[model samples]
Target: MKKLKNVLMVALIVLSIVAIAGCKNDDGNETTNDNKEVNNSVDSNDDKNNDDNDKSDTDNSDNAQEDDLSGLVSVSGSTSVEKIGIATAEEFMALNPDVTVTYESIGSSNGVKNAKDGVTIFGTASRNLKTEEKNWGLTETVIAHDGVAVITHPSNSANELTKEQVQAIYKGEITNWKDVGGEDEEIVVVSREDGSGTRGAFEEIVEFEDSLTKDAIIAKGNGNVQTTVAKNEKAIGYVSFTYINDTVKPFKIDGVEPTAENVVNGDYSISRPFLVIYKEENMTKESKAFLEFVLSDEGQMIVEEKGGIKVN
Candidate 1:
């Protein structure tokens, strides 16, 4: 009886041991499966993040490449804007040596014509584009506001004149400076050639379009008009406000001086726009960048330094 009881106890102990070993094997498999699932999930997230980062990098790289520029840009237009344009070009070239910018101080009408015909990338005009010109799909950006100064030789005795009197003088009604309280000499009417932006603005402002005296001397540019008046003691002419130098004397109109401050305050009635024209649909990358720089704060500063009133 004792031996039978001892055998039963041993058999029960072996069964219990086998059962514990089975539980441990099942737990180990479940733990390994859970670890694999968690690791796989983490790896999948990491791959997605890497792909997004790669796409972001590509976009940034594309932008950086676009910012890199190199090419030639041609600008031509109003002689009035020539000095400012050249200064702007020089500064732009200094900053971007890879890009070459050239400016030609041809007449404003030629500049508009060239820009419309695609002969040049940019055109400068002292006057606003005509109504017919807007139909050509050309756009004008007013970069500055300038005054048309009524200038005379410093030897003249007249300090100022009424707007009507100035108009009459250009129209040949007041042929003698003595008629407007000047010397007894015959007024040497120095006028700009036709198609000159200065001429257009002056004629339009003075309300004497197509009526300038036939005997008036036609000068090609502002410098020429200044030169003519500078040497001739009896000469009277008009120029852009910037050209008002010691060589020539500026005449006040309607009790207001031809000054930047006067123009800004609307006291100067002979103010005109300085225009930069371009084609709306077909701007090159370099050309667009150049225009952006011209409108920038630095560019406007250059405009002021060059004796123009900033648009802003």
Candidate 2:
């Protein structure tokens, strides 16, 4: 009886030990599965964070590139282009605070010479490049179209003139306004000084190059011509269409009115190109940016606002 009881007790102890070992093994598997789930969650969160960080980096890079431009851009040339040039420079400088743009109102020929001599980044001219100028490796970019307005005093009765009539007046052939259908008054012809783009274009278009009468008064700039004509009832002069004001009246050429729309549509006969000249090889990044801006919609709007015709 005692041996039977002892055998039963030892069997019970072995069974308990086996059951405890089975429970421990099951707990170990559960622990390993829990650890794997935690690691997977951590990896997924890390990937999302990495993507967000990459996007942030890309945005910053783009901003840096957009705001990186800085330098000086110099433009020298046509006094006739002064108002538009200075207005453009003001707008460009406003947008690019780090850049400085300066323009000098030397005559158009001097503007070309200064650009060729590397004294300016851009040279503005109211006339197209001459054959000799094109041969100098200087390229002209026409930014705007302008009409050379034949202006006279408001009191003058003359409203229009043929190209031939205008040529005759400047050549001292027609000395009285009465010959051109105006009142009996002495015709006072005014012209621009030498190296003047306005004078160059006017002479070329009129086929009266080098034949301007010595008796004609020579003015320094477009404003001077406007002023001279305004002050003298018998005076006649030429200026950019941009300079036409209430003080002086513009004469129609061949019956076509001198106006911005007329200049753009090819109906105006006394029109010329407004140009910016530079060597392509010598173009700097700042200059390129400025040119691009001048051709932009906003820049062209400024051109129109300043009484010039937009070309681009």
In order, how many clashes per candidate? 0, 0
Q: Which candidate number would show the highest TM-score if scored against the true structure?
A: 2
lDDT of 1 by residue, 29-62 (tens): 9999999999999999999999999999999999
Top-lDDT candidate index = 2
Residue 10 in model 1: lDDT: 100
| TM-score to true structure, per model | 0.80, 0.89
User: Per-residue lDDT for 58-145 in model 2, tens only?
Assistant: 9999998877778889999998888889999999999889889999999899999888888998999999888889888897888888
lDDT of 1 at 203: 89
Clashing pairs in 2: none
